[model samples]
Target: MPSITRRRTANVGRPTSAETDILAATQRLLVNGANFTELGVQQVCTEAGVARSTFYSHFRDKIDLLVRLATELMTSSFDVTSAWKPSEGVERLADAFLQVVKVYREHAAVRRALTEVATYDATVRDFWSQELNQFTDWTIAVLRAEQDAGRTPADLDPVSATRLVVMGGERALVDHVTAGDPHADGAFARELALTWWYGVYRRPAHHGERSPS
Candidate 1:
C-alpha cells in the first residue's frame, strides 16, 4: 500500500442538516446538467435554500463540498467491502463487487462530476487516489491471508497482484459505467471473479485428480 499525506482543515465537526442539504442540492444540480466548474456558490445556496454565509461556514469552497460528496460515495461503497470474508466463497465475493457497481450506477451523476473535476483539481485527485489506495491495501491483506492458508499461490507477490486487480478493475469499471450498457455489469463481474480466483487464489492441484499418462 502507498503512503498518503492528507491536508487538515480547520472546519472539523459533524455535518449539520443544512450542510447535507447543500451537498444534496449540488448533486441534484450536476444531475440536471450543470457542470461542476460552471456552477456558482450563489446558485447552490439558492437551490439548497441556505444563506451564502451558512454554506461557507460548513465548507471552505465548492471543491470542498465536491470532495465531501465524493468521500461519502466511496465510503458507502467500502462499507460493503469491509464485511466480505474470503471463506464465504467466490460467489459471495462476486456479489460484493456487483454491489459496488450498483453503487457507482446509483450515484452516477456525482461520480461523473467528480471524475471531471479530478482531472484539473490536484486536491480532488489526491483525495480519490488515497481512497482507492486504501481499497487496494485491504485487498492485499486478504490475498496475503489466503496465501498463509495455502489457498493462494505462495509464489505470487500480493502487493503486485492486488495492485493489478484493484487498480485495473477500477479503470475497467469506470469505463464500463461511463459506457452505460446495462448488460455489461454481470459479464464483467463474472470475468473479474474468475481472474481473482483462478489467476491468483486457486488452490494447488490435488494428486488424486491427476490422470495417469
Candidate 2:
C-alpha cells in the first residue's frame, strides 16, 4: 500500500492511485468527526500511512483534498438526479431526489466540508456554482420536453423556472442534510415532487399566461 501510494502521483490531465489512500484516510478521519478546518495534512498523512511528500504531491492542501472529494460527491448526487427526467412523473421525480438525499447523507462528512469550505474558497465555490448550473441546464431541457408534450404550461420560461426549481431545491436539500433530520426526508421529497409537478410541469397554462403587448 505504501509503495502504491508513493509511486502513483496525480497529473494535471489524469487521475492516479496516489490519492486513493489519502482520500480514504481523510474520509475516515472526517467520518470519525474530525473538524475539516482544523484537520492537518500531517494527520491525514499519518492516517493514510503515506509520507508528507506523497500527500503534497497528490493535493496542494487540505482544502484541495476535501474539494476533490466534495466534487465527487456532488457529481454522484447529480447523477442520481439525472436518472429521472421531468416526464418520469412525480413519484419517480421524488424518488430521484430521495436517492440524491441518500447520496448526500452517505457522505455527510464530505457534504459538511463542502458547504463549510465553499464559504471562503473560490475553487470550491466556483465548482459548486457550476454543478448547480449544470443541473439547471439539464432540467431546462427536460422541462422543454414536458412542454413540447403539452404537459407543462405553454408560456413557461424553462430557463427561469428551471433556475428557481433547481437552485431552490438545492438550498432546501442542503439544509435538510445539514440539519441531520431523517424524518423530514419523505415530506421534503414529496414537496419537491409536488412543486415540480403541479407548480411547474402540470400547472394550468392560463395561470401564467400573459397579455399581448
Candidate 3:
C-alpha cells in the first residue's frame, strides 16, 4: 500500500469516512470504464459527492488515489502467498497460486486500470515495480531456502528463475483475464501451478518415492 515514488504526507492518519467514500467512488468509476488518464479530479469528486477541495485534502491527485486502490488490491492478494512455505510441499504452493488467480479474476477491472495508468505515470510505474518485486523477492528467498536444504537444484540461479516464473505467471494471468474467458482460468491456474511446481520446486530425484507398477 506504500507509495514508492510519492512522498509521504506530513499529516497522515487513518482515512476518514469521506476519504473512503471518494476511493469507493473512484473504483466504481473505473469499473464503469472511466479512462484513468482521462478522468478528471472534479469528475471523481462529483461521483463521490464531495467537494474538489475535499478530494485534494485527502489525496494529492488522481494518481495518488489510484495508487491507494492498487495498494488495497495488491494486499488482498497477499493471503495467497502468505499460505505458501518451502516446507509445506508443492500442493500447497500450487493451491496458493490458484488462490492468486482467483483474486486476479475478482479484481480484474481495477487491476487492468492500474496497468493502463502505469503506462504513462512514473509514480504508478514505480509502485507497480515495487509491488511485483516484493513477490519476486519472496519467491526467490523461498527457492534459495529450498536449494540450501538440497530440496531444489542449487545450480539454478534463484533470482533469475524466480523473475522468469513470476513475470511469466503474471503475463499469463493478465492475458487470460483480458481475454474474458472465465472457463480458461482453471486451466491457466493449473498450468501455471504445474509449471512452477515441476519446473522449479520439484527435486530431480523423487522417482524412488513413486509407486511401482
Q: Give the top-scoring candidate (TM-score).
A: 3
Give the C-alpha miss distance for residue 129 in model 3, angstroms. Answer: 0.9
Alpha-carbon lDDT, every model = 0.78, 0.76, 0.77
Candidates 1 and 2 compared by TM-score, better number: 1
Q: Whose lDDT is higher: candidate 2's or candidate 3's?
A: 3
Q: lDDT per residue, candidate 2, 102-195, as tens digits?
A: 8777788887887787788776777677777778888888888878888777899999888888888877877888795798887788777778
* TM agreement with the true structure for every prediction: 0.86, 0.82, 0.87
Query: Of models 1 and 3, which has the larger TM-score?
Result: 3
Model 2: how far residue 88 lies from native, Å: 2.3
RMSD after CA superposition, every candidate: 4.5, 7.4, 3.1
Tell me the tens digit of each residue's lDDT in model 3 across 99-171. 7787887777788888888788888888888888888888888888888888887788888888888888788
TM-score for predicted model 3 compared with the true structure? 0.87
Encode model 1's per-residue lDDT on 1-213: one tens digit a residue: 332224333355687788889989998998898998999999999999999999888877888888778877788778987688877666676788788888787778788887888899887888888898889888888888888888777899999888888889877777877795878787777667667766767643342222211
Indicate which candidate wins on lDDT. Answer: 1
